[model samples]
Target: MSWKPLRVLTPRSILPALAVLLVLLAGAAAHANKPVPFGDRVAEPGGADASPVTAQSLDTAGLELKVGPGLEAYDPATGEHAWSYRREGATALYLAMAGEDAVVLWDDGLVTSVRPSDHEVRWHRAVPGLAEWLRGEGETGAAQRSETQRKQLAVERAAIALYTVPEASPWVAVVTPGLTMGFRDADGDLRYNDRPAGNCAYDPVRTVRTNYAVLVPRTCTGSGSNNHQAFGGITGYRLDSTNWQLATGPAVAMRALDGQRVQIEDGPVLGSRVFDTKAAAPESACGSRTEVFAAVRPQGTCAEPVANPGP
Candidate 1:
């Protein structure tokens, strides 16, 4: 049987196919070994007071932040240390992102903004009367030393709140149990101080931030009895100005919801009502029994409270 001459494979005909296969394989291998966007990890340094209250991936800035007793930044792609700030006696309570910088609120009532790129401090401000309060020297009246101690403990245990709207010029708000302070992110200058009206003393129970406003649920106590007769209400402070208007009256609890809305549980008579933080307009929830206090997102999906978990 005369078999046909064996066909000869030419290098020119097979080279192109081989090259294409190699290129495809190379691409797949590269993709498989590529670093994930937010998969970088870092361990807390030794002697940390508590676990990080906030861990954020600053993808645009190539940094990752972990805030607790101090603030630390790392390279998001490699988990390498970028910079850190630790005060001798201060503990960080809350953190917020202001444009490209990180705003940290210390337990000692100090607010600072730092650039994560080079660890440069943009600006720092100590809240008025906070140092004295921390030292237990701000108390007045004829209460015993133990009662002053109790008040000091309450002040130390008070919740801290931070708000920042990312923009070309961000707006930052720092809320404490005694005062609510706002700052312009561009210059870090004090913009507004929403102090208690008249003789009423402000005790911030909770705070939530929206794109346009900061909603604070405060217990305003009258001047008598060492300002112990307190009532609850919700106030919305505009981020752009010093104007703040009351949102709800006699609320026992307040919560932040989606769509820039806040849920206010009135003092039994009005039940719970949800309202827009920007416009102070109420949203009807009918008779639904959804627990508003349990639904409040104090950190707005970014940061979590370092202190009390429930209202």
Candidate 2:
């Protein structure tokens, strides 16, 4: 009976509690429906542009794409274009997501960093030797060059590719047939320029970014051997220290996997095994025996092959 004279809940006190509950419920629902980060989204194959070369998703913002003439960012939810950049004669050779920025490698050897949010060109840098190579090609008439010369030039051009290392501070690594260079993400300043060691010709096929390293899988052909007989292996570079080393496991071409792992064919009968890069050096028994014809990233784990193999 002494219990407070049947205390009634005051509207003021109850109102605040109700408001907080409603707010939390709204927040939880909003969070549940929130768009995932663009980088987390698996890029689709098409976009609004004709012959859309590539379409990359930006999660909540939209999808960025390399259309026929330029690069574009579109709102996937609304199917509305957000931003685009185009030039008279520019072709995007490669498009990669670098954190919040987009790193585009042009056919002319120009590398541009664009902020997808506002379509701002953060910085642009020209790859070494590309300008000179282009100029040389322009200077020579098709009739003046020998067939062998033309073929060689074509091979060299084909060897040029872009590799974005998100583990390396979102740096863009330009690997040419002759040399490799790394650039800073913030300013596009040169970070390191060095040719791969050894007399073997290194044709970089793909780059894999681990949690702490950047791995480049290259076909290495000895100086005198035909490039067709190249062997595949990866050169691992420590992102923090910038030190380069060869992977300790088998030379059989391996494909990068999520969670700092790689999948390589164990042997003809053994099928394949997935190796974690973060683990200690691979066992010596994992030595190279079978040739991995392709050094591309597998779609998933060892179960699937590369859906879109790199050049």
Candidate 3:
């Protein structure tokens, strides 16, 4: 809900998407009802010509700093623009170092990598949704969200986090409203595999180590928002040594609640895990052979366990 200029720091080994993280408070629907503000990305007034950003660190390594609109570099020290990229609708988010190349990005998706010296395109890809879409019900909703999602997307706003570990793979955390949390490798491959549920937030518990655990929140189906409905258990996924290299696990039965406690029965789970095949089986046998994880309730009991495909 606050807007501050992104500061350029000396490249550190690890960086969280400091300027790119978003938090959703409880009781807040996942939609554009009470929209959170995406802060502006400009320097404070009267301090525009105060300092020059030279370099900064990202999830991978230290990247040189140059300011510009697209796949180009701007010299704050010299006030000169170098390098250029041609894209239909390019949203300049932040610049990071990808190996030895300067990577230009607007959000979780990569735009192109350029050389700092000449702004030459090393690698490039088309990233969709440079503009964040927040569709409201009608006129009123449109006006409320228009001031937030629209204006931010106009500037190509991005929510990014960077991190690194010793002897571990480098990773970048990205949060796009109404999208899933995405973790990208230095090579640009999505290390953290998650399908957008149209809504998501970055949680380090599952992402930092690639647990591949599928989180299944018990669904509560109720008529109102005050009923006491709960779920049988939680589900998750793990990497399998065989098969699709991923296996499902038994459900960790936990108490589930409706968002309003009244809509429990009608409130289905907003989280899920995808499976290659949709077949009914014992909860314990789920982790045996599957690329994805799912939940299976027992015959006599309402509670279920997370499933695995192949072990």
Candidate that scores best on lDDT: 1
What is the alpha-carbon lDDT of model 1 when measured against the actual structure? 0.62
- Which candidate model has the greater lDDT, 2 or 3? 2
User: Which candidate number would show the highest TM-score if scored against the true structure?
Assistant: 1
Cα lDDT listed for each candidate = 0.62, 0.57, 0.34
**Alpha-carbon lDDT of model 3:** 0.34
Ranking by TM-score: 1, 2, 3
Write candidate 2's Cα lDDT for 112-136 as tens digits. 7877766677787877765445334
Worst 10 residues of 2 by lDDT: 36-45
Q: What are the clashing pairs of model 1?
A: none
Give the lowest summed-lDDT range of ten residues in model 1. Answer: 36-45
Q: How many collisions between residues are there in candidate 3?
A: 40
Per residue, candidate 3 scores C-alpha lDDT tens digits across 137-230 of 2335566665557535433344232222211233333333323332333455544443322222222122221222223222222322254333
Off by over 4 Å in 2: 1-51, 54-60, 129-160, 218-233, 247-251, 264-311
What clash pairs does model 2 have? 38-58, 38-59
